[model samples]
Target: MTYRLKYGTGTEAVHDAMPSIESEQLSLALAAACEDPIGATEVYGEDDGVMRTLVTEHAIAVLLVGRITKTVTVLQLSYTG
Candidate 1:
């Protein structure tokens, strides 16, 4: 099932401040996560499947996947570009 994407408290602001290209790249990465949260991202720390990390060319995002809700919440975002 496809998941809904949501940004955590400060994640949206951080994403908004990034360069257009970088932001778009991150957006695409997040879109992929929405389609396949577990398949599109790597485990953040443990093999739990709920906490994940998505890496794009210019950013790394920490995400929390809610299986029951079918949502991918971006908890943190770091721009490297």
Candidate 2:
């Protein structure tokens, strides 16, 4: 269910790849981060310059859960496999 936003998967640098995470996957990714909000996150305020990690069984993705939109706003993802 977790949509993995792979960074530096290939020869390209992480900065070069345009993350292609979807809505459903975004939700799943967020769910994953929520699993361990305390350990996996270093964010506060819930929005406006906040960030969190969406934890999952096999993968983890970093996203910004915007206060107003309530959606996966940003990505700083990497695969753990």
Candidate 3:
């Protein structure tokens, strides 16, 4: 099943403020995560499948993958480019 993507309270605003090209790259990365969360993201710290991160050329997204809910929630986003 495909996971639904959701942003944390202030994360959407952060995403909106990113440069357009970088934002698009992050969007595509998120979409890939939604389609295959485990395959697309790396474990943030531990090997736990839920806490993962998606990294793009310019940005890194911290995500919480909820297997029960089939959702990928963006907990934090950082733009480095």
Q: What are the lDDT figures for the candidates, one per model?
A: 0.93, 0.45, 0.94
- Pairs that collide in candidate 2 are 32-54, 32-55, 33-54, 33-55
Q: What is the TM-score of each candidate against the true structure?
A: 0.96, 0.38, 0.96
Cα deviation of 19, candidate 1, in Å: 0.7
Candidate 3: worst 10 consecutive residues by lDDT? 19-28
Off by more than 4 A, model 1: none
* lDDT score of residue 43 within candidate 1: 88
Candidate 2: stretches off by over 4 Å: 1-49
Worst 10 residues of 1 by lDDT: 21-30
| Candidate number achieving the greatest lDDT relative to the actual structure | 3
Candidate 2 — what's its lDDT? Answer: 0.45
- lDDT string for model 1 (1-81, tens) is 799999999999999999999998889889999999989999899989999999998899999999999999999999887
Model 3 quality (TM-score): 0.96
**Whole-model alpha-carbon lDDT for candidate 3:** 0.94
Residue pairs in clash, model 3: none
Give a tens-digit lDDT track for model 3, residues 20-64. 999999999999999999999998999899999899999988999
lDDT at position 58, candidate 2: 40
